[model samples]
Target chain A: MNMLEVTNLSISFGGLKAVNEFNLTIKKGQLYGLIGPNGAGKTTVFNLLTGVYKADTGTIVLDGQDLVKLSTIEINKAGIARTFQNIRLFKELTVIDNVKVGLHNGTPYSTFDGIFRLPKYFKAEKEITEKAMELLKVMGLEAEANFTAANLPYGKQRKLEIARALATSPKLLLLDEPAAGMNPNETAELMNTIRFVRDNFDMTILLIEHDMKLVSGICEEVTVLNFGTELTHGITADVLNDERVIKAYLGD
Target chain B: MKKLSKSTKNSLINYGMVIALYVVIMIIQLCGGLSNSMKGFLVPVCIYVIMAVSLNLVVGILGELSLGHAGFMCIGAYSGAIFSKLTEDTITVAPIRFTIAIIIGAVFAALFGALIGIPVLRLKGDYLAIVTLAFGEIIKNLVNVINFGVDSNGLHFSLKSAMDMGLAEDGKIIIKGAQGISGTPQDSNFTVGIILVLITLFVVQNLVNSRDGRAIMAIRDNRIAAESVGINITKYKLMVFTISAALAGAAGVLYSHNFSTLTSAGDKFNYNASIMILVYVVLGGIGNIRGSVIAAVILYILPEKLRFLSDYRMLVYAVVLIVVMLFNWSPKAKEFKEMVSYKIKGMFAKKEETQA
Candidate 1:
């Protein structure tokens, strides 16, 4: 069953077609990959799906709810959460606090209750802290829960982003270049972590990547985007082996 | 009871510090060590401390520079003073009357905060600062021309002069244009100011540690990432901005009530006053609530106390200001302080081992 379905997604900036005629479908438990050369609009597609940019024409259906008209915050409320290409953790906040911020919408308490420390404040905050700790433990960051987000090592910061996104309890998780600045060992560990999240959390993740090894190693199915359009989509092996994809990444 | 979180411990320390300060001041007063001038500085110091901490919310946590903070204070001052002037006879009880005045002022200020924040919060960086600066001036000037009167008939308002309001003989002018409001019961004292200070501290410090505070600080740290994680940017920003404004208004109520005559005619609520409050936040170290409290107290009392060295008073004051700013903010100073603290802790550990 499809968890997220995007049809005819297109957006433009100053007459430049950043993303054009984009279409994607991800099954409920499948780990999907979005790959393209530099400037081929992979991030733009993420922005479109996440409502960072309003689509000029398209429908984004996630779990049977249309999200084209929703704002970025509302889109996340509809069970879609995203991480940035460049790590966007709340740098000043502690590791666990970053996750608690993600748990914000999930746990509801009025600002009044918080300021005055009403009975509800203690209950809600206790619930939120416990939940955030669990997510941190899942990401193997429970030990560093009190460390500042920026103080964590590079690979661990990326993991923190994943942990934070998970705190929101989204149905579809979007990862943008999760292994961009990591060593080979970290990349290997990240591949295992991604698979583990999929199995444990029952998450359907869509990611954009330039590392073909990471893409081919973990992705069940791949969609290749070239020049703001879908060049090919199929099983990972077949799509990565396509001659046109190689040419698009390399030369004419 | 369960173990406390690190943040909760820090908050407890801050509250303890405020209580300690209160006890020390009260002790000094009881011993009759406080001078006439020192006692005079007491309530104003509390007022400025409240102002500094409230402004810190915008400049530090909210990550927005607001130059028009004094405008909200002006609103609170006038509204509170006017209320007190109108209800002096009906509500003869001072504490109850003052509490109601504060609530009225805070609410009145919060409403204006929402009004100005809608347009002002939309701007960024220097534009936000410029607009807020303009707003501060506008509010001060606006209050200067307002003539408000209350009579047996009803409340009366005029932009021109008190005579234009056509109030009856029994009616009293609450605010007489440039004269402002006079003869309002002086319900604020050093003790009441300290209580308000504690209340402000409780509200601000607790808000900073709460879940909503995390969302607010998240927006400050990274606006885009916050939104991506499902945090509503505008809602949190406006909410914080309004709260900060309301707190400033509360401070204004304390300020106006302490004085027999309350007026915005001079530089009390001017651009300079706004900038002075900002200086307290900055010198105290932005985002440090405890530091704001200390900075407000010291900076306010330093100049007044330095009257003995009249010739070089401001010069010495300037040096102290720079020293405090550097000590609180400079990286080298921070490292040195941390190293010294570590050394002290290590000494205690060695002594404990020796005792064992």
Candidate 2:
């Protein structure tokens, strides 16, 4: 069964269609890539899918649940988690605490349990901490778990964002420009981490990337967007070699 | 045995200050070192501490600037004071009546908090602050026009006049317009105030340290990221705001019961009062619970202590505030503060080991 099916997804701002009639489908455990020019509404598509932007028309079905009209948080609970292009970490919090915030939805303790420090609170908190620590370790961020998130080096901060997203345990993860700031060495490492996450978590992953090298490295299937519409989509090599995608990237 | 975690150590230090302050106050009372005026200020200081700590939950943790905390206090004060008054002749026991009154006040304030928060919390930053400020003004004006009375039949309330309340000849007036509630039972004392502060600390501290608190802070740090992480933003925001308002209401109960007469005007429970409470949170260092307590106490007491400066009293107080703000927030000072706190933590660890 398809893990996600977005059909005729459309949104506009002041008569300009920011994302028009966008459609996508990904099978379970597929590594998908979304590549577009700067103004092609790639981020807007992510926004619509995650409920940040209300669609004018269309449906986002993830694992058979309709995501339209749901709030961002509801969509998240419905198993869609995403990272940002700008790297939004809880900067003042410790790295582990940032991950723990992602683990919050899965914890079963009520507010009363938290305020009273009930046995349930401890049990859930311990499990969350252990899980958060494990994610940090997987990202090679165990040594920096206690450090304030903003204090980390730039590359580690990117890795931390992915680790934090994974802590949400989403059925489908959306990563936005995960390698935007990294060097070649760091980008190679992130590519490995991305594949490792898909295989280990057994989750479908979709990513938006500006780097052709990074997208071609791991994306099994790729979609190209230009001017708020899909230009082409096929296997990675075919999509990259498409005449329309070349024109969209080169302008005019 | 495992060593203490950073959070555990931090909380120990926080509560330790509370206990130490309580001990010092008890010692001073026993030794009769405080003058009459200083003694009079003790309960008010405790009340301010509770208000500041509670306000910090919204201003610091939730990252929403609220300017109508005093409005919640007003709701709490009037409700609590009236409850205590109605039960005065019937209950005959002070502590039980006061306890019930505090709960009533907190519940009413919490209800209003949820009501107002639903609409106002949708706005953010300066807009949120302005709406809350308007709410505070509206509350103050509403209280000014209110006329309430209690009779053998039941309670009566009217906005027009006391005559419109339709009370019996022997009925007692509970609220009389701008004069506010009078003849309220003065059942609250310094000890009781301290106990309530401990309760406030327990609730606020536990909430801050818990997983829920992490979610709230995450929302504060980055709203989009928090939403994408499956956190119910409205739910958490309402929870913190209501809890904060409830605690402010409890503080209002303490404030109301400390005196036989309570008024809601100007310095009492007005806009300035709300801003003053926010000042306590900001000046204390946002998100620093222990700092809020200490700042509220010292700032509340400073004006009284600076009376020796006479005409220049407020000027000196202003200077002190500026100096403290810079010292607390300036980058260089922040580094110095971290170093000093690190040293203090080391000392505390050694002290703990010796005791163990």
Candidate 3:
């Protein structure tokens, strides 16, 4: 029932190992968390998972498809979608259009269909608009669908990124610091949104976060990483309470 | 896009603007308000409009700088001119022949655009601009050294000269070295020019408002985010780049036919020519397709009309550029314009409500 199985994932920059021997497994529709301190290669692990950085040695299998050596775009097409640690919304595009860009692969019409404005173009576009709107409404952003993404409030921008990621309709969603700068209330809202997406969209999420409260609140399981290697991982409560994980996070 | 959609509204506005310009020109012609010189300027104006609009695709939407746009234009002009020159005897029908020539120009320019885009688009930077700048210079110089001819033995070409072509005694040089192509059937007219402008507008605007266009702009806005969302960066970038080049080719075909002789010398396919088109795109509000059309008309016509400004024509042109830049880009000016437009819309809404 595993949707994503990654083992022995490794990458290096020069002589330094950025992420080494990373192993992760997420069951279908499970919520997972990856927590690590600064310079501990959490984002690098996300990059490795998304094929942004080709793993030096590892096997990433999503729904029985081998993901290694695939390009970032191909990895996405293989059902792995990610959000950046820093919000990377298409800032100038409208909120709905950003989601539609994610829905680009699902667009049934060709460029020719679009250029000629054929009947199929109209039909396909209507479908795409409705679908993108559906995703925005799920993210509670229907009202600001026409607003440019950069103009959105910070909490809303984070939600927009999640909406865009869901537009890809991937089984496994990778969120890197989704609640990075949110206030406490926004973080609580995001936790609920994350759970809502996982339940309603049939999505399995693996997030990296520094916010311990958010991680423990929604994560079914947690993995602690330090200095390019796993510190420990288990049930969310146990991992958060582990002495070594705490020492790794805040040195004694 | 569906009817009354945001993009649909923008596209209708763009199409209406171009159609309105066409109507205005026709009216001036009917009233004999157009002087001979002004009449001569019509096709050139359309040509620049097409060029600016197409360039905006690359510079504005796709967010790539292309300095070699004129190189593609040169390729289009020469390829189109060569086809027309050789087919002068067989394709006696000017319309069919010119249509084929435009297609040839577009294809060749697209071929080169893809050729250059493959290497440059892979790397993220102003590499495209730098390489294209060099490409424009090289293509211009390259045309000068090319010699082309036709004879009983078929087509012959050489880099040296007409003598090096070694054609049959009955041969005629279609493209003599340094002289470029001559005797190309001048099938271009203002009506045709405007029609082609409309077609180019239709293609570029439609592309900008489509799924592919959204992907392209996403890549422009954030390459990493676009990649994560499954948009193929190279494919979309190259697609827009090729389309832009092809439209420039069509414009080049129109331009070459405007002249009795087609040559690479002067501002026709030089670096300055490419920069001039870029200026229109930038001053026109980058991704604003309709703005590009207006900028091309005003910037192109102003200097000619202001030739009456005597020695200060260029000075006046510089001032006009500053004003246009301010009007198009200054945030305060943008806010003011938006406020005015809102008021105008409100007035219309109130009138309709009262009538209701």
Native contacts present in each candidate (fraction): 0.88, 0.84, 0.97
Poorest 10 consecutive residues by lDDT, candidate 1 chain B: B116-125
lDDT of 3 by residue, A129-240 (tens): 9999998888899999999999999999989998898888898999989998999999998999999999888899999998989999999999888999998988999999
lDDT of 1 by residue, A1-252 (tens): 999999999998999998888899999989999998999999999998888889999899998999999999999989998888989989999999999999999887898899899999999988998999999988899999999999999989999999999998999999999999999999999999999999999999999998889999999999999889999999999998889988998887
**Candidate 2: misplaced stretches above 4 Å?**
B338-356
**What lDDT score belongs to each candidate, Candidate 1 first?**
0.91, 0.91, 0.90
- TM-scores of the models, in the order given: 0.98, 0.96, 0.97
lDDT of 1 by residue, B202-303 (tens): 999899999889999999999999998888887887898899889989989999998899888878899989999998999988999988998899889988
Q: Which of the two, 2 or 3, has more TM-score?
A: 3
Better of 1 and 2 by DockQ: 1
Q: Model 3 segments beyond 4 Å from truth?
A: B1-3
Clash count of each predicted structure: 0, 0, 0
lDDT of 2 by residue, B1-356 (tens): 88877777877787788778888988988998878998899899989999999999999999999999999998899999989988889998889999999999999999999999898778899999999999988988898889999998888999989889989988999999888899998988988888889889889988988988999999999998998998888888999989999999999999999998988866768889998898899999998998899999999999899999999999999999999999989999999989999999999999999999
Q: What lDDT does model 3 reach? A: 0.90
Residue A157: error of model 2 in Å?
1.6
Model 2 Cα shift for residue B350 (angstroms): 12
Docking class of 1: high
Residues B1-356, candidate 3, lDDT per residue (tens digit)?
Answer: 43497677888887887788889989989998999999889999999999999999999999888887888889988999999988899999999999999999999999998888888788665776888899899999999889999999888989998899999889989999888888878889998999988999899889988999999999999998999999988899889889999999999999899988988988889999999999999998889898899889988988899988799999989998999889877899999999999999999999999999
